[model samples]
Target: MTLNRRNFLGAGAAVAASLSAPMVLGAGKPRVVVIGGGAGGATAARYIAKGSKGAIDVTLVEPSRTYYTCFFSNLYIGGFRELSSIAHSYGKLASDYGINVVHDWAIGIDRDAKTVSLAGGAKLPYDRLVLSPGIDFVDGAVPGWDVSSQNKMPHAYKAGSQTELLKAQVEAMPEGGTFAMVAPPNPFRCPPGPYERVSMIAHVLKEKNPTAKIIVADPKPKFSKMGLFQEGWANHYDGMIDWIGQDFGGDVVEVNADEMTVSIDGEVTKVDACNVIPAMKAGKICEMASITEGNWAPVIGHTMQSRIDENIHVLGDACAQGDMPKSGFSANSQAKVAAMAIRGALTGSKVFPAKFSNTCWSLIDTDDGVKVGATYEATDEKIAKVDGFISQTGESGDLRKQTFEESVGWYAGITSDMFG
Candidate 1:
């Protein structure tokens, strides 16, 4: 039988149970502080509070009141989903699970005293800290691109207003105009995100302005799900997209936001809209906490505990876990493992072996969907991939449509899991 949303969720029940086992606290309640309210942080916060049954005090620090997921924002750009559909509120996490939701910036970390300093002049003490702060762009990763220039050439990588801005820019483009994208380097958040964004942009253009063209200047030789994306692009929107790899001088690129032009290996081309997805590093809070070794924080595979500091566990795109792509699904899976281990350490709950899984689905046209996924197990050294699968080229249209529907179900399920 074909996989549908209902059965898929039923199958996940056992997995969820293994990760979230309630604990009975003995005496002094342990305090857990979670920074960042995105995929990993929010899930970690929810599991800890729900599993501990008020035995552990869970406080979540996030700057944004409404969290816009970066996962399906591309679908919004393609006119497949509403902006309100992808935006989530923290009220559910607070009211339903009794998590202490603090909407403030975490400015400093006092590791010696085990306290986190807030921008509002309050210090939160944590017995165990879970940091899932996500990603921040590296300075000068793309020359002539910076935070100040984001308004002119929106990255739209973080979702929210940036996503809105990018969509508006694409819609306002003149007929037969150019949409240029500067893809990021390796080990970035959402391995297939940039290509998916390209597909969405192409979808929009195919409807609004058929003559428009997409130019992708990628730094890497190949990208995630390359064969599927290329095949879909050919079959769905042929001759509308041009993907330039590193061998063709796509690696070395410079942009002039003021001039509305990009220089790729000394060749210049003017564009109506541009998206510069710069290289990413662990969020600044990780650096502030002194947990980051280089661009990412190193964590033990079984528990996601920071190698730099045992009391702190890093999750999601910010962590340097082996073989896991920096997708929201990976973060959410890792969050469950960390939550289980934290409960075990603090409340003396039973700790189970870490098992993780992730599936990334991208829509080419309306029902033309492609995916890649894997199941993983934690070894002593790294999170190792045990089994994997990908959508084969030239699959039946019915399978692709089912895959698309499955993705829709997954979005609903995972968002509910994370926010609630």
Candidate 2:
């Protein structure tokens, strides 16, 4: 079957009409169903199908045909990249890897029956299910703000239309206007994301509207690479960035979207633009599956398999995998391990012990970047970080530039690793 966007949708509709019960395994090739098609899901689908060598049937379910990554999205906001540069197509995963790419929403999972119900009414049976639905905002986490108020104060965390919307809003800011940011709490998708976003916005304002102000009301006292980011902001964007930590009313923030105002410790400040990143939890499908222990699915680290159901493996930001930060690199790393284990279980392939690694890089300005990374090995309990390195606060200009270049190369490499 030729798998293009239009053809795939037509075939999916036909399949949905016929699908009734779960296909029993052990009668034919083992089937694998992957939900969500970003870093974790896309990479897991590609690797499992490729490694299984036609021994396992792979079906990847995602709603969008094109995916935009959240990793380098700050660069897009910083005016360092174009929207097309961050967007990726799933055509290769379907045509090149012999995987069934179904563009539809996965509504529910019947774990006991080993079948997944789709929004399109299809039931896909799987010997093993890979759920990487990513993060969803926690309801009521931000007062006076909800998805409906997103147009007024964008989150831009999902890195597609919201990202574009935020960018356009930032560009449209009036001269010398105030831009406010309400960052998330702990255990969000990326540890450095909010700070990196602040830097990117500072970069844009520095060039476009130098007199404008950027106010950050953060719930946390400190953030990832705090020293480096603080240093960079001091050196590069002094007097323009006002960061309010938890100690100074940053933790107690309320927003009036209708009035375009933010209240920090009851001191209301009117702003021209706002970006609110609320607390997040595992995507809704995780709850639908009844596999989630709390907000996140608990997974056995060695194999990325659900501690609740061995037949299912949860990867990326949606899983509570110890010591692994929720980032694109961590998700892609976890995907390979899950892929290998699934192949071994289904196709009788050799599976090695899981090893994971991640490096989070943030660009402070043009050719100014810093990074923190670690290599990890799975223990009996969790994935534990082994050796790690972080960019020094007083690093040389040359070294910082080199780090930025490395991040550029990494963005190219990891996106290819995920999509292709």
Candidate 3:
């Protein structure tokens, strides 16, 4: 399925249904506890509540009151968008859908008891638990770098204050200074995210400090939309970006946050700004619940249920579902599937075959955008990709502009779908 504005809107509409008669399992309504109020959790909560029509009780646990989307944070870094533009609230999900929105950190999970322990000393009991807590950086994945050094070398991957800090650091760079980026390896959140950040940083530097240089040391030999990003870099910001992949010792890297320096291939270079995106793992809650297999929770594609425990469903970047990249669109797609399954299980609603789709859009410069996406279906083993498409190199300017516009529309539509 080609994912356009019409299809996006149609998908959102499809998730909406009339009230269904729910099975009375106990004294109260079927309870669903969803952790992480980002794309997957928010969408799942909204879909379940809307589809069930008071049949299911949904409680969403998230730490932040204002959720900043990682999808468009790069554009905020490039000054194309304001900081407020990416920030979202759970107001709609609560006011419109009647979801019990709890602002707190989920510290522990007792899978045997089907309860989640919050940092505020509250316990949430659930008939079904949805874990969509997103990614957490692997400790020691990047040598000499950790959360403590985030002020000096901001990861900005979580898209909040770190994003503001990184943008401030970039704008504060001295003339002719170097900006360094340590990109993470594969199976991380948003495959094209780090590269898109580079483009946004380059875009900023080209306008403010033209002589400033950008260096990216990536452990991966190749990245998503490589050809398109390379072409855009050459066309828009020539001689401003240097990308060193694994072949060039980019894999052998370390950082000295105190010295504001990076060591790639044993060569040290001082940098004014550094964005250290370390290797990622499933959010800590998955491990706490003992559902993780080597950093991620394995899930059945048909229902997004944890392989270890069927009562728990894992979505988004935390799950090891096959084929789909770790992206907001992928998570949103998975959430609907999980929502349908949960509704079916709890309310005896009709269940349909699972279908998924994702489209990742990247902005190279003003009005210059590209995208890659695919359609997927749930097989017995995995969420297998059916077909895919990408923006070709040397595309016409009009098409690129159209693609960027399409992405803007998607952001609006998806946010509405998730939060409402």
The candidate scoring highest on lDDT is 3
Show pairs that collide, candidate 2: none
lDDT of each: 0.92, 0.91, 0.93
lDDT string for model 3 (1-420, tens) is 123222333555333333232311223367899999999999999999999998888999999999999999999999999989989999989999999999999999987767899999999888899999999999999999999999999999999999999999999999999999999998899999998899999999999999999999999999999999999999999999999999999999999999999999999999999999999999999999999999899999999999999999999999999999999999999999999999999889999999999999999999999999999999989999999999999899999999999999999999999987
| Clash pairs, model 3 backbone | none
Residue 317 in model 2: shift from native, Å? 0.4
Q: Per-residue CA lDDT of candidate 2, range 1-420, in tens? A: 123222334565555456443432223467899999999999999999888877788999999988999999999999999989999999998889999999999998998778899999999988799999999999989888999999999999999999999998998999999999999998899999999999999999999999999999999989999999999999999999999999998999999999999999899999999999999999999999899887899999999999999999999999998998999999999999999999998778999989999999999999999999999999989999999999999899999999999999999999889888
Q: Which stretches of candidate 3 lie over 4 Å from their true place?
A: 1-26
- Which 10 residues in a row give candidate 3 its minimum summed lDDT? 18-27
Q: Against the true structure, candidate 1 has what lDDT?
A: 0.92
Better of 1 and 2 by lDDT: 1
State the lDDT of candidate 1 residue by residue for 241-356, as single tens digits. 99999999999899999999999989999999999999999999999989998999999999999999999999999999899999999999999999999999987899999999
Cα deviation at 265, candidate 2, in Å, is 0.9
* Global fold similarity of model 3 (TM-score): 0.94
